[model samples]
Target: MHDGAVDLKAEARARIYAQPIEMLDPAQPELFATDAMWPIFERLRAEDPVHWVEAPDYGGYWSITGWNDIMAVDSNHQTFSSADGITLQSLESKAETARRGARPSFISMDPPRHDEQRKTVSPVVAPSNLTVMAPVIRERAGQILDGLPIGEEFDWVEHVSKELTAMTLATLFDFPQEERRLLPHWSDMITNAPGHGPVESWEHKRREIDAMVARFTQMWNDRVNAPPAGDLISMLAHGESTRNMDKAEYAGNLGLLIIGGNDTTRNTISGSVYALNKNPGQYRRLREDPSLIPSMVSETIRWQTPLAHMARTATADCELGGKTIKAGDRVVMWYVSGNRDASMVEDPDSYLIERARPRQHMSFGFGIHRCVGNRLAELQLTIIWEEIMKRFPSIDLVAEPDRTHSIFVKGYESLPVMIPSRN
Candidate 1:
């Protein structure tokens, strides 16, 4: 662990037992970045599952730490609106985004409008579509694994995780394959805070987004002019509801699709390698029985919880888990914490690939807002692991992964690993 992580752990340790449970703040980004958040969540789940904390940066928010509580909040979309936002952005940042005229996406909308817009892109990842995509995904996964440098250290996040996801995302949008790298780049800029990770400033983020809109606008125009097709752009251009969307709405949906398509699966791919290495017994079981790939993929998603928390605004005063939330209060459902709630998941902390009900996870939000691309994410992960088992005896992690510096995206920036050459 880095010195920063050590300090955060020390701080958490000092606070976990010493401070009042109501005062403990689990939304601190450093805790997530260092992977030292488990203990904090564990403490919250035990002592105060519906904990409240005030922060100078993001203001006061309620942390719903338990699995059932999170499910309640996620499922009760009418009472907890996602329109104000689905993240813990600072009040200042929220005001600034509004000042700059932020657009609305289905993820941040409610009721009739959200449903109508979501249906536009739902078919892209439908079961029938995934069946058609399966072979293409497998072929890409094979090529990516075969191209890895055996017996040499390399960044797995870069070579395999990002590359494969980018390829799939490009195919989804029918985006230019040559420009596929931009998909992840835009996703990073959209999610990362300024002065952390790739984003240097909010201005830089704006410029990159402007470029993205320009590119997508051209695609939108072209697709609208042409006959209806199966790609995401074509779906949006020709779909009854989305066809008349304004620029802001179009850009909003594009950002949603890009991040949804890129980050969650990309991080899970990296996490699977790290998780398997950390649990060698599980790795051995996996190697011994490759049929466990599907279950293992679900387990990895639960263990990783790629997207940590989704914020919701209380539509009206309500009581939850013994705490009262007032109207307009920010209620954050910590999926990262919920996924590990021992009350719900058996031995939740351990990376047991062969769990009886591996698919019962909260990584994908529950109810109507559950991830539409979840099946596609699972497909990518399953294919990659199957391909990995076929080629390499083992992949050894050379160093600790460089994790992302955001609480929202539980992901690795890089994971150094080496694959031994076959004799």
Candidate 2:
């Protein structure tokens, strides 16, 4: 690490530790943007793995940082219910959401309903479909990479990461590929809050949602009227469990799918480049053995846990980590923190693409809500890297990334990069 970066991390640690433990609210979005959340998670994991926060805005929420504890909370969905909604939304935001369009995605539902609803869209990413999609991803990735101007600075996130994911996302919904840019924008609107990031205000966000609803609802109507097809919209339109869904439910599902299909993979694509830039040794090793693409993909997902946290409401009074979590209390399992737990992962902070057990991380949650599109995300990363290896020997990170300002979506907004020459 550079002397300045090391000093900044040390400063952040001191400042974070100087504050009282009880006052810590892990949901703060600003910390993630400035990349200061790492030290905060470091402190939380060390002192109070199962910590509590009683913020006026957030009310009371539990932050689970340890790997095993997070796994327990994630797997036992019955006790830690997702029905209240995920990602630690504030009371005001929750109320606003209900009034705005009631985006009640299946990911937030429990049991039979969640399973049935999720089942409708699972086929899009099935092994057979992923096989079909792999070559398409490679072709698009190659085209995107080829289009980049050599020896000139450009935002990698815009040119490659976002471009590839947006196309894939558009295909999954059978939406117009030309309008693929809207997919990531809608995903941003889903997680954005007034003043925190992309969203300017609740009204501004509501307007964005309105545009999304109009577009998605039109697609839903078109797909529902047509014969059953292979895309996600058609699957939901034809599936018994989803066909009768209400408007709000449909909007919710669309938002979830868009965000799910975009964020994790896009962020990780950008993160992979940044990680390799920082850990040049790993990049050198990878360039020599292109066979290590899969391992590198898994390691990048682990290193850049795109989703920071998923919030669950306790269904009943439960004992976790020797603490009593009352029924109805908000509990947030920090995937980002668990992915960095040294107890489970050796040298967790270090970015090692060739780790022995690279996929042993919580970037994709466990149990019923485990990411359905995980394999597709991996496939995209693997194919992109494979295609990239066949082109450029290295991508120069011109500057640090412009990260997203949300504790929910740990991602990049822009990553400036330059390729000096193609191999």
Error of 2 at 269 (Å): 0.3
**Residue-wise lDDT of candidate 1 within 278-334, one digit each (tens)?**
899999999899999999999999999999999999999999988899999999999
For candidate 1, the 10 contiguous residues with the lowest summed lDDT are 14-23
Candidate 1: segments with Cα more than 4 A from true spot = 1-11
TM-score of each: 0.97, 0.97
**TM-score for predicted model 2 compared with the true structure:** 0.97
Candidate 2 wrong stretches, greater than 4 Å: 1-7
Highest lDDT model number = 1
